[model samples]
Target: MTELRNPVIRGFAPDPSLVRVGDLYYLANSSFEWFPTIPIHRSRDLAHWEYAGHVEGAAPGGSLAGVPDSGGIWAPSLSWDGERFWVVYSIVRSVGTPYFDADTYVSTAPDVSGPWSPPRRVPSHGFDPALHHEEGRLWLLNLQNDHRPGGRRFAGIVATELDRETLTPVGTTHLLLQHDRLVEGPKLLKRNGWYVLVLAEGGTGFEHGVRVARSRNLTGPYELDERPLMTARDDPEWPLQKAGHAELVETPEGEWFLSHLAARPLKTPEGPRCPLGRETAIQAVTWDAEGWPRLRQGNARPTITVEVPDAEPPAFWGAGNCARSPHPPAPDNAPPYYTLRSPAAPSWTDPTSRPGRLRLRGHHGPDSLWSHHLLARRITEHHTEAQVTLQANPTTFTQSAGLLLWYNTAAYYALDLTWAEPEGEAQHGQQWQHTGRTVLALTTRDENETRRAAVQEVDADTPLTLGVTVHRAEAQFWYLTDGTRTPVGPALDFTRLSDDHGTRLRFTGAMAAIHAVDLVDASFTADFTDFRVICTSV
Candidate 1:
């Protein structure tokens, strides 16, 4: 058997929706706020996964500007019905408020990798929507939210018929299941003349888990299973905690597997800190004597390793789980380039402008929700090194371009190469004429407070190399000095970028970015190349 590592798709990849098309398996996950919404990954062995593509035009106007963190696309439900693949998701605008303040949309593609249709708006009953196809009929499943005083946030599971042609609701929505304990992210299927409903129960935290229910009818009372399908909530020492938000799929060999969201929390004095965010994990499943799904025998909770059929590993493997694999190397699935919120502003960013370089025109900076000239990739591992080479000579302090570790507008760290004059002698317009030298600087922003450190000064004529090594909850900056690399600045707290740290809710994790800004005049430009993130376990 081929030993498969858990968290097949790691880092910030939460709320997974799995589907099997022919011999290939394609899965989609929630991409909140960040553009290039609804990232999809494919695999053959269900263990080694690779990035396929994402639902590109899932947002209106190609932008989700002003949407709060964790408030854009949430819990995409990916499914296939004979010819095309269908994806349904919700765009949450207001979080933590009584009202969900969300809009649901649906899109389809002939293949997993786009040519996806522009998203069509549907009813927004709540969040975590799913699309199910059964016996040639289409249905939409979502969790109804109660925003009123003294009402439960997760009211119940609801379902409605949707036209296959237009994706509009056919009739009134019906309540499927109600629970005293929390339940949502409902995925439905049919097996042995029974309609099965799997749900994410409790919250998506340490108390998270998977619950099961079954019914003989499509829309009716669902009897809760005698036992939970899978969970790690009760086991504090479990490596894979927050084991919930799951979907199940069948292999060509008729084997069953469960794809779910889990987190690897580090034991800190303050408590357990999940710096890597919720990740995607898989568990081998089997039907019990009574038809309820159960994890592998002898395993009550999720494990780090699983065994697959002793065959060729999955065709599509992302970054190839080198942390524990004993096999041939797979082509690195380190995301292809980066994604932008707005369409690549031809004036701001263009790959064809400079050969072998991604040139970006500095604009609104990283804090601007509307117009940001930022290009970034998701930080998929906690212990990772993100580095980039920049070719830019900022004549003024207003013009700066460098590497950024971004986690929304408030929390981030950057190593920018910008012009710096001797304190009071530094004038904006006169910077070009002054003796201001180029300096590699470090800046950290926690909440609304910002701190800066001038790491080292260098000649502006030479290209500068900058990088950051992240070890779990701390990040240390590095810069090329003389001929050797040297560390700079204190180890910044990486955990502060998590969803639980900020004043408001933060649904997303950290991302490595490269941005340039010309606050004074948009005259200066920066050329960035060789941007890479190497994932390693320390």
Candidate 2:
């Protein structure tokens, strides 16, 4: 046996749905507003995991345009029906209100990395939907939402039988369970002639946890467990916080394992901030004499390590929180590249425009949800460094390209290369002559205001290399020239780009991104090469 770390898959991977087909285990996580929705990963030993692929065409109309942050795809559940894989998820539009305008959909694929079927709208009670197959019959499970004022947002758990061939409701909806506190994200399994229901309790923040219930009947009353199966709320200082939204899968040898989401926060002067966002974790589980599930660690808190059956590690293992390149050294796995609100289409983003370079045609800026030309990857570790060589000819300030540390539209830090008026000259643009110089500007934005941190004029003929190093709560931007690195901006507060810093509803994590903006005519283009990111636990 070997001890596996708590977060088998790290970074902004939350709402874990685990399933086993044959000897392999496949996991899916929520993508929110990011494109290539519902990323999938696979592992042979539940210790070393690698990126497989995402649910292709999962987004309706192949786009999440104008979807609010943390409001696109939520709590994706993955299941295997002996022949193909089924995924159920909800596209949430409105949040932080009584009306959670949302729609749920289902899709199937023969392989994890697949040509998936077009997503078909299904019966939606609420988000965190799942599909259960028992004796060749399909059942849909979801959180029933009461959107009316003074109504419980999480009303209860509901179930409906669906026709397997067309995925249409076949019977009346049944209310399975309800509780005084918030309960959602339900997964069901059969053990010892009893139907076991697993749920997520509280919210997805510090007070999150997993609860269990059992019933002899398929859609009837369930007995809630005396205590939570997994949580870290009791220990505020524990390394893993917000432990909840879990599912269980049994190995061929009858060993049970639970997959859940947890967050590791940076203890800041004000409070704890989870900049990397909730990640995917696995825990060993055992059934008690009463047929109730419990964590093998013998407590509600999540363990940092778990013992699992021995297996060979993947080729891309590294040190410090198991940190490795987002793009693995091996060429077989897909890199975790994501775009905001839209899929990476040839009309806006092109990798084949130039050899070894990614070319992005500018659209709206980062704040625009309808047309944002941003390409990014998750910031897996607190101590991370990212750099890229940019080639762009920005004739005006409206056209710019840069490296950025982004949390959402309202929170980010950017180092952009654009045309600016010469020192001691009029800041206004002279559109006809373009009387300006190429400059690198560092800007930071939060909910309060947008601030210009610093600026440096540079030669327009040379390709510039921009970089940022994030050490916990602080981020410093710099540029490389003549084999020397020069700081362009003072250390800025990286903690603001976090879920806990803003007052409004925030869910997604920090990302290292490269984006372009041309508010003029959406015709400016930027070429980037040698983009690299390295992350480590500090």
Candidate 3:
């Protein structure tokens, strides 16, 4: 027996689509506006998983330059039909509006890390589109959105058969099921001559849950399940919140398990905050005499630990023995770093320019949608420390570069090396004009306003080490100079960088990043080295 901890895949990995191809299991998760769009992971015993590769060029033209936050890729569904793997997802252009303005596409590859086929546009009924391959025929499942006034945005779940060659609609579109509550992320499987449709009920929030419906025929009036297969909505104090969007895969020995997304919230003064965003979790599944799938424990709530069949402990695991894999690490040539709104192209971001260092040419400010030169990695733990050595000389106020804790354009905190004028004594009735001094500025941005939290003068000639430490909901920024590390700012409210704090629509998780901005000209370049991030579960 293997002890499986909850959140088998940790941090920022949400809306998991799991599939088993023979003995190896492959999983894919959504990458909304970040490049290296769809991240794929592989597991051998279902207890230990490793980062195999990502769906290269998943983003159209290798860029999502102007995509709105949380509005690029939503609920990508991965499947295998004997030969190749297929990925279907929706790219939402407009968020927080009635008109999602979404486009769905499909791409196939012989292997997960592939020379994938160019994404061909598919029929888009709404976001969270999924593909079902049956009897050599492909079907598309999606939510039908009614955009008219007073109409339901989540009108119903619809399925349409697609022509394998042209990838177009062929047969009649069938309405699978409808409910008063929100339902999306439909996954189908056949069991005992019954076609079961697994659904993500409610929105992706505290009220999230997993519900099921089944029909005897491929397309029909489906019967909604009496109870949810799994949820934490009724249990507010449960460690895992917002559990839904699940997919199931059976092992070679016929044991079944479900993969879903859940969030771990930090207890705060006002409320709970989920800084890490939604993560992937697995639950054992079993069928009853009535043929409905239920949790192995016969309970609807999610557990922190589950036992599985046939597994061995890995040589290394994450803090708390949670979800790090023990497989041999990927080659050093390919690092797991992501860039915003664009690919890591040599035009703006180059790694070979400075040999051991990464060179980033300053582009637009962090608030810009077109081109923001940011290199980021997902924050995978509640307690983390990240540091980087930066070599940048910004002579003007318009040029700055530094470390960033980014959630979105509206919410973030940055400790930057920039130019600021210092106060000086002047002659009687005359003002003294002095060159601006290089200063370390800690700034915070939210929906209300952007304000400087602290500032300190620093020597401009020497390379500087900037670091941030986050423990639970609080964060502190620091800098190293002359072999001494000193705190640069007050303890910040890291809880503000969460999906529950603001009123805007946000889906992605927190990220520790290094960025540069040259609002005047895109010529200022910053070289960064010795970038490291260490995270542990609290």
Off by over 4 Å in 3: 311-332, 347-353, 424-434
Q: Is candidate 1 or candidate 3 better by TM-score?
A: 3
lDDT of candidate 2 vs native?
0.87
lDDT ranking of the models: 2, 3, 1
Summed backbone clashes in each candidate are: 1, 0, 0
lDDT score, candidate 3: 0.85
Which residue pairs in model 2 clash with each other?
none
Q: For candidate 1, what is the lDDT?
A: 0.80
State the lDDT of candidate 3 residue by residue for 414-532, as single tens digits.
99998777645332321124566788999999977999999889987988999999999989999997778899989999989988888899898898999999987688988888776
Candidate 1 lDDT by residue in tens digits, 1-538: 6777878777778899999998888889888877667888877777767667788799888888777656788999999998999999999988779897989999999987788999998878899999889888899999999898998889999999998888888989999999999999999999998889999998888888999999999897899986788889778998999899889898888888899998888776667877677888888899988888899864558888887765455543334332221111123222244444554555433435565577888888767766778877666666888888888988778889999888878888989988888656635567657777778889888887887854577766867788988888788888776867788778888777775575777667777788998886677789887877777755
Q: Which ten residues in a row have the lowest lDDT in candidate 3?
A: 320-329
Model 3 pairs whose backbones collide: none
* Decreasing TM-score order of the candidates: 2, 3, 1
Candidate 2: regions farther than 4 A off? 313-335, 347-353, 429-434
- Candidate 2, residue 434: lDDT: 53
lDDT of 1 at 247: 90
Candidate 2 lDDT, 173-264, residue by residue in tens: 99999999899999999888999999999989999999999899989799999899999999889999999999999988999999999999
User: Ten-residue segment with the worst summed lDDT in candidate 1?
Assistant: 323-332
On TM-score, the leading prediction is 2
Residue 312, model 3, lDDT: 51
